[model samples]
Target chain A: MINLPWPSGLLAQAAPAEVDYIANSWLGIASYLIAAALFILSLKWLSHPRTARRGVRAGEIGMTIAVIGTLLIYRAVSYKWIFIGMVVGSLIGAPMAVWMPMTAVPQRTALSHAFGALAAALVGTAHYYTLYGDAAIDRFTMAILAVEVLLGSLTFTGSLVAFGKLQELVPSSIKGLPNQNAINFSILGAALVVGIWLTASPMQHWLFPILIILGLAFGLCLVIPIGGADMPTVISLLNSYAGLSASLMGFVLDNYLLIIAGALDGSSGLILSIVMCKAMNRSFTNVLFGRMEPSAGGTSDDIYAGKVKSATPEDVAMLLEGAQRVIFVPGYGLAVAQAQHTVRELATELERNGCTIEYAIHPVAGRMPGHMNVLLAEADVPYDQLKEMDEINPTFAQCDVAIVIGANDVVNPLARTDPNSPIAGMPILNVDQARNVVVIKRSLSPGFAGIPNPLFAADNCLMLFGDGKKALIELVAAMKEG
Target chain B: MHNLEPKLFTFLLATFLGLEVIRRVSPLLHTPLMSLTNAISAISVVAAIQVMSEGHTTFNHVLCTLGVIAAMTNIIGGFWITDRMLKMFRREKPRRD
Candidate 1:
């Protein structure tokens, strides 16, 4: 059989032979290039909701091509193990994809980041051990692998912690742990120092596992103190870490496609985390250190005492009846109660009654960035009616009734007025400017900032206290009847 | 090309391209966009494949198998969920004039 090498143009055709070295090589490169293009196109397609599905198709196809290309290149001694893995993965993953409610997207996303990072970490470990045993590892490869494993392991545990917090399986915030940030920094510093040591001396096999342990410990410490309000930034940061780990693994394994995909994922997560931090007027270090100030102070009663007016569902319905334009401000509480559908129902009733309906979306609303949009979109809320914070803030005064549903900080007037507050200078929905502000909340409980909202006590604001879903349902029924 | 120089170049350029593309994605589609990018990144399963084929030891295969499973799950689950979520974002039918 005749054959060409890596640079040969005749790679489109290959002679049949054992291993088929040149044939597989060209095919691999071709597949990776096509997959890379497809991946880029996939994200590009997401620029609009109308074209997003095509993007998904592109991503799916890209992944398919990459997988098939790998199988073509490396013929395992026994494909059974790889086959079993794929089958078992499909069995577990398909249900997770199909059964997860839209409200659980953030948790599901965190879990996936964990899985992806863990996978990369394991592969890197395997490669490192294999080379160590052969006594053939190089400095560059070792250094990159050490960093990869560190990042991958931390990302693995960080994403899990994030998932746990989002699932409420663990406390979302653990503050005032006495030098908590110091402890976290030390743990992270220990892991990095260990990673550097591992790079210099690959013979000290015990150090590799120590690095893993420290990485895992640091991830836990890093995420535990992050409050509920910082979830969007935390999740985005985890996503970025997971992607960077994978990218570093790509360098370790010399995989072109992995590098491109990882870079894309990393940059995407980076941009989102930045956006989330900006929305809250926070820095990356503040979120990284997991420092949130939840003052259990006298503000709640002091601000809310005699100034508050608690109303019934019927009162809210009556207000809606008289209102021409109504805007909804949803938050984490709405997600917690799974009240998006009920809110949609209320919006429909309002629409039918000739009331203009718009949803005001704060950038940092819900458990993650854009989370509220996904929930509302799932409820079949028209995309056009979902107005962003800046777009809708100026129009709040024209709104006769601003219904704050399971929301707190985003609509709090304090974010704009109080410079010393935790959420100070954060762009809020400006719901107070509306003629009548009705807050549908469970109670006078403070939000993640652990501060009382002055909006609840304003003369124009009426608190309709109840479970979010139940309250929205009652209001929807009343709206229909009225 | 001789060292990791070309790869570093590729990585930087790809990340820059990603930022621009992701920036344009409507905030409304951020959830789906995240899932899609993650699924694409899970293509590191190909690397896991290469590792599994390297040595005949049970330890290597086991680790590689587990790695493959994790990446596979991310790819399947991520794409499937992203597709489901994107489909949920719909526009209202045109109203009568």
Candidate 2:
């Protein structure tokens, strides 16, 4: 809006001077303030499940108000393209919401960030060009604009890579030429240097395009080396970047509500990223700089070297017969194998046999934080049955059977005993402490941490070698037969 | 930098408020929280609309149109996905087929 070159002659013919003044008057400020308050209340309400729906509703209302307020104050001369855009957007958005499986939610989130950041980048680019004609380049404004575009451009491509990784369009592991980390850092460093130079000299017209290219390339590089295991942190970090860019865009436009709202978004995303890093027991640097360190204590070779006990579905069903309490631990493998429904069915059959069932969710389990919760919730698992790491750890000791469905490092006892292991100090569900442990997996393979799990070799642990979904179906059938 | 005092103040205040508010959200809602934030950040759609409606040149129109399309997708998709996710969080047992 700030960048659109308004023709002075046409503006005089469109509306009287008095009408223009009232449009920007106290009414507009009051509406924006109210919208801001609603946004704050919406976030507060979302904090608890009891009021989450209401919170979502509040946010919707706030967005509607913000859109409407902008319309009232800045009356557009034409509405043709706006209507077309809204219609097309709804057409795409509605079906996507109705049809996308919950398993694809992480990819959906990354795509959303990509779109949002693209918008910000376009706005920043438009602003630079429009203001350049007037030569209204000032040091402070130039610096802010540089940051806005830099963050926006990087987030746009960075989020796309994240989407590709989550959707598996690209390999989830480090791809491309070797020395990939070095190349990525160099792109980032070059972007920063170009961005700084542009900030100092806004009129260096040729430099702007270079800055944009560098930024987009840097985003691609920044995310390419990161594997899917660190997806939560990457997604959260990208969200923070998008939010900060929007906030800086607010400054360039001098819109107070945009500033407040964008900053709120930026900070929340930053906090989430930090929390996600801590949950994995890794610092931001380690996650970014260290390609996942292979666990020192165990490897796939070591897994086969140790004695691993294998069991059949019938054996697991028989073990469950007299079990009073069963704990289900899920990991990324369960998601990859699309086994949530089958696992739920197995739990239900077990419950009918007078067994109690609960889910033990590691804080960093699955690809994203709370990913397992979404999977289970989609399969209609009761909310009460899913317990957080702290809430469920103690219960594992009393658990008659802990069925680890395709989980690995999170249950690795090396975290507790081996100080040299990559995942040392990270809290794991004490599934190994259960009287009996059954792990359903295809083979003796390392997980995201690239670690061999000692839990598989434990005295009570029985490995059921098969795909998660097929194995769960077999277990359910055996349970029904028994 | 000194001239940006008001904007900086707003930024700091909002950052503090955001940290406080987000901490209260249960981990179960982290996904929804993220989607909601993505939607709000697309508030720049307001700016995009202004640009399109006030079109001066064909080039400007094209740029703004792209902005409108991208931001609208984010806003619409973000909200719809969030609502769907929140619906799944109901405490009542989902009806089994």
Best by TM-score: 1
Estimate how well candidate 2 is docked, as a DockQ score.
0.56
lDDT of 1 by residue, A1-482 (tens): 11113354444445566336766777988998999999999999989988999999999999999888878777553589989999988887898899999999999999999999999899998888877777767778888988888888888988898899888898755553789878988988888888888778878889988988998888877877777788899888888888888888878777778889999999999999999999988899977774567654456878988999999888889988878999999888889899999998888888877888999999999888799999999899989899888899999999999989888888878888777787888888899999999998988988878789999999999999999999888888877777
Whole-structure CA lDDT of model 1: 0.85
Query: Residues A1-482, candidate 2, lDDT per residue (tens digit)?
Result: 33221233235545565656454534566677788888888889988878887877877788788777776666643466666767776676667667888888889888888988998888788777766756767767888888888889999999999999999998875555578778877887887787778778878878888888988998998888888778999999999999888888888876767788788789878988987888788988888767665655645566556578999999999999989999999988999899999988998898887788899888677777678888898888877888888898987889999999878888988889889988898878889999999999998877887777888888999999999999999899998899
Going through the candidates in order, the fraction of native interface contacts each one reproduces equals: 0.75, 0.59
lDDT of 2 by residue, B1-97 (tens): 2337877898899889999999888888788899888887778887666545444565566666677778778778887787788787757466465
- The parts of candidate 2 lying over 4 Å away from their true place are A1-20, A175-178, A296-306, B1-3, B50-55, B92-97
Worst 10 contiguous positions by lDDT, candidate 2 chain A: A1-10
DockQ of each: 0.65, 0.56
Error of 2 at A299 (Å): 4.8
Task: Kindly report the docking quality category of candidate 2.
Answer: medium
lDDT, residue A200, candidate 1: 85
Q: How many collisions between residues are there in candidate 1?
A: 0
Which predicted model would earn the best DockQ? Answer: 1
